[model samples]
Target chain A: MFDTLAAMLDWFGIVVFTVTGALVASRKQMDAVGFVLLGTVTGIGGGSVRDMLLGRLPVFWVAEPAYLLTCVCVAFAAFFLAHIPASRYRALLWLDAVGMALFAVAGAERALLSGTAPSVAVAMGVITATFGGMIRDVLGGETPVILRREIYATAALVGAALFVLLSLAGASREAGLTAGFL
Target chain B: MFDTLAAMLDWFGIVVFTVTGALVASRKQMDAVGFVLLGTVTGIGGGSVRDMLLGRLPVFWVAEPAYLLTCVCVAFAAFFLAHIPASRYRALLWLDAVGMALFAVAGAERALLSGTAPSVAVAMGVITATFGGMIRDVLGGETPVILRREIYATAALVGAALFVLLSLAGASREAGLTAGFL
Candidate 1:
């Protein structure tokens, strides 16, 4: 039951990241293919890095085509939807935040399962949470959030550590994610 | 003596990566600052991702100012030299191959020392080898080599596995790298 919920959350995170990436690509006047590329990278780049680091096989997206499919579908929708004035940047930012929070918790959990130390797991969590956006920004010719004087990496670190602490205390994964986000 | 040699090789790799990245930026009509960004990312991005995966702390460039300095200096040089008829795209491709080869061996060695399995070490090696170029291409709005019909990732994987195998058979690090490259 919890596994199902976690899977759903992961899917949600992927969709949100894709949407945010598509919106950014739109602002850059990129074509539809470029939007899809950015969206896919934003949705999977961090987790792919984390998995490769942890020595996990097949990578997260390769292991399950669902995430990749979701990203593609979301990007296609966003390419058209981004034409609407209602696609506010502020809303995309908020959604990206939510996605980041969820991905951080997921990354930390995966790191812990890979037998990494708590501190390392926390760091991986932050990497997994923020790296997609960082890649998107860099590719879009914008300064990465990590390179800027932003609260981005710090927020990811805090959220990841909080999730780890909650999970170590025997909280459910959903609870841990909620605690981290809150 | 070996340490000095290793340091030289590492710096050489850094310079090559930085030059290539800066050249790409120049072709894109990016300014000096854009060249700097591209150069830095190409030089350090691979190793940073490798360290993050190996659970290493602070990342190499973040720990060693010299690495970042080297990249910055190369970027500055490349920026000023951009007006030369360098046929930068071809040069960038070849330089990228060298960087990939060096980084692949280094990353595999690090992973092996950290007690990762041979297969995982090889994967890490590929990540270290290709990730920077992936970042460079993506940021430059080009398709990543790994995602293309290139033999790039395969080359890295073969080289990394050879390195790990040779090291396990008691070959020196230098010998392993040479064998891997060959």
Candidate 2:
């Protein structure tokens, strides 16, 4: 039951990241292929890096094609939906926040499972939560949020630490995720 | 003596990758900061991914500031040298080849040292050699070579296999690098 919830959250995080990345690429006036590339990278880049760091095999996306398919679908949606006159910037921000929160908690858990120290796990969580967006921004020729004075990576780190503390305190994963996200 | 040679090759690879990335960014009319980001990512991105996969700590460029410093210097050079009209495409292709060869040999050696199987080590070598450029291209709004019907990844894989084969035959590191590059 717990595993199923965690897996769902992971997939949700990937979808959120993909949407954010697709939006960014649309704002940059990239073509469809470029949008898909950015979206996929934003969805899986950080976790791929984290898995590699943990010496895990095959990479997460390669083992499961669902993540890549989600990114592609998001990219397609962005292509048609970006024509709407709505405030996409706000949507992008919210989706990015959700992705950051979910990815941070999940990444920290994975790091801990891989035998990393608490501090390192927290750091890896932040990296896993943010590095994909950083790559997206860099590739899109924009300054990454980390390079800005925005409350980006710091937020992820705090959320990860909170989740770890809660887990150590015998709280449920759901409780920990809620606390971290909140 | 071999350590000194390895260090030199490592620095050379860093410089080449950085300069190439900066040149590409400049052609795209990006700012100085953009050039630096692209250059650094192109230079250290592959090795960072490789280290993460092998479960190495601190990452290579993060632990050794020399790589970062070399990239900075190379980026500076590229900023000034961009005015010259010496076939950017050709330069990019050849520089990529050199970078790929060096990375393939280095990655295979590192994977072997980390106790990976020969086949996995070769795959790691190919990933290390190609993934940086793949990331660079994707971010630059270009098709990644891996997705293209090019001989690029094939070259890297062949090089990696050659390096592993030579090493298994008790050849020196120098000999392996030479054979792999050739």
Going through the candidates in order, what fraction of the true interface contacts does each contain?
Answer: 0.04, 0.06
lDDT of 2 at B80: 74
> Where does the lowest 10-residue lDDT sum fall in candidate 2 chain B?
B57-66
What local lDDT does model 2 show for residue A148? 45
Model 1 chain B is weakest, by summed lDDT over 10 consecutive residues, at B144-153
Q: Give the local distance difference test score of model 2.
A: 0.77
Q: For candidate 2, lDDT tens digit of each residue in B1-182?
A: 65676566666777777877876777666655556656777888788888876778657654455676677677777877776857887788888888887887778878887899999889988988887887677666566768872576788899889989998899997898788877
User: What's the TM-score of each model vs. the native?
Assistant: 0.57, 0.59
lDDT measured at residue A104 in model 2 versus the true structure, 0 to 100: 90
Give candidate 1 regions above 4 Å deviation.
A1-182
Give the winner by lDDT: 1
Tens-place lDDT digits, model 1, residues A1-182: 66666566667778888988888878877766667667877988788888877778446664455676678679978888888857567766787788888788778888887889989999999888898898787766666767763576777889899988988889887788788776
